[model samples]
Target: MSLIHVNDDNFASMVQKGGVTMAEFGAPWCPPCKVLLPILEELSAELGDSVPILTVDVDESPVSAGRFGVMAMPTVIVFHDGEPVEKLVGLRSKAAYAAVLAKAAALSPESPAAAR
Candidate 1:
């Protein structure tokens, strides 16, 4: 599956859905956020429908960030179903993101949206 961009309108449904969702909380002004987009896309393509990669722009959706208690930009929060499974804050490498995704993939009981 392709990446899902989360906003105020879709936040509830995105979080409540089944399967693995890796939500990236980012701000357009942040340089690291720009660097991470392609990496996210690659990961999303690699994972396919088994896991869905979701991105939430902090500048676009402050409410979502506040709800997630995100104090910083570029926060990567992974969820299984309606619950959180893993979180990574600040700038990180593609390997790091993959490592977290791998953990989420292994830990999640059901197949990820990307794998589907």
Candidate 2:
């Protein structure tokens, strides 16, 4: 599965749809953000539909970025049931992101992963 691209317009709606959602707030000029893209893509495929992974370009979605207080270029926020639960700033290991997703999935009552 490919990472869903979101913007200020649809960011809230997409995350509020329910369950656990992982959103990466980044900018096109950010080298780390560019590097992290493929990692997120791999995670998106590994997690399948169990978790919805989204990408937001900070430059284009300043409203959403500012709403989340995303000061870094590659800030990853995990939301459960429309609420932010965990956040990671800057570059992190793929395993670190996976761990955060696992935690978010377990916290969301609507997530199929939560029942496991």
Candidate 3:
């Protein structure tokens, strides 16, 4: 599935749905955020509907970013069952992201949205 954009208005509702969700907190102006976008797209395509990816722009959604304590531009938080399970800061390789996603999936094998 494609990345879903979450703002202050929908962030709560979206993440509250549970399951394994990879939420990236960053702003468009952040250089690393720009570089991370394509990598996220690739991961999204690879995972398909198994895992859902969410993009949260810090500038536009300060509440969510602040809640996650995202001090950096590119902060990727792996959430399972609507709660953060892993937090990664800065740019990382696709393999690294995949590992995190795999861990998140492993943590919630019973997740309805988790595609095996």
Whose lDDT is greatest here?
A: 2
Is candidate 1 or 3 superior in lDDT? 3
- The residue pairs that clash in candidate 2, if any, are none
Across 1-113, the per-residue lDDT of candidate 1 in tens digits comes to 67789897788787646566789999778998898889999988887767778899988898988988899879999887768888899888989988877776666555653
* Model 3 residue 65 lDDT score: 91
Residues 1-116 of candidate 2: C-alpha lDDT, one tens digit per residue: 78999998999988945688999999889999999999999998887888889999999999999999999879999998889999999999999999888888776666766654
- Per-residue alpha-carbon lDDT of candidate 3 for residues 19-80, written as tens digits (9 for 90 to 100): 77889999889999999999999999987877788999999999899998999979999888
Q: lDDT-based ranking, best first?
A: 2, 3, 1
- Candidate 3 to truth, TM: 0.91
What would the TM-scores of all predictions be? 0.87, 0.92, 0.91
Pairs of residues clashing in candidate 3: 1-48
Per-residue lDDT value at 57 in model 2: 93
Q: After superposing candidate 1, which stretches have Cα over 4 Å from the reference?
A: 109-116
How many steric overlaps are in each model, in order? Answer: 12, 0, 1
Worst 10 residues of 2 by lDDT: 107-116
**lDDT score at residue 57, model 1, on the 0-100 scale:** 90
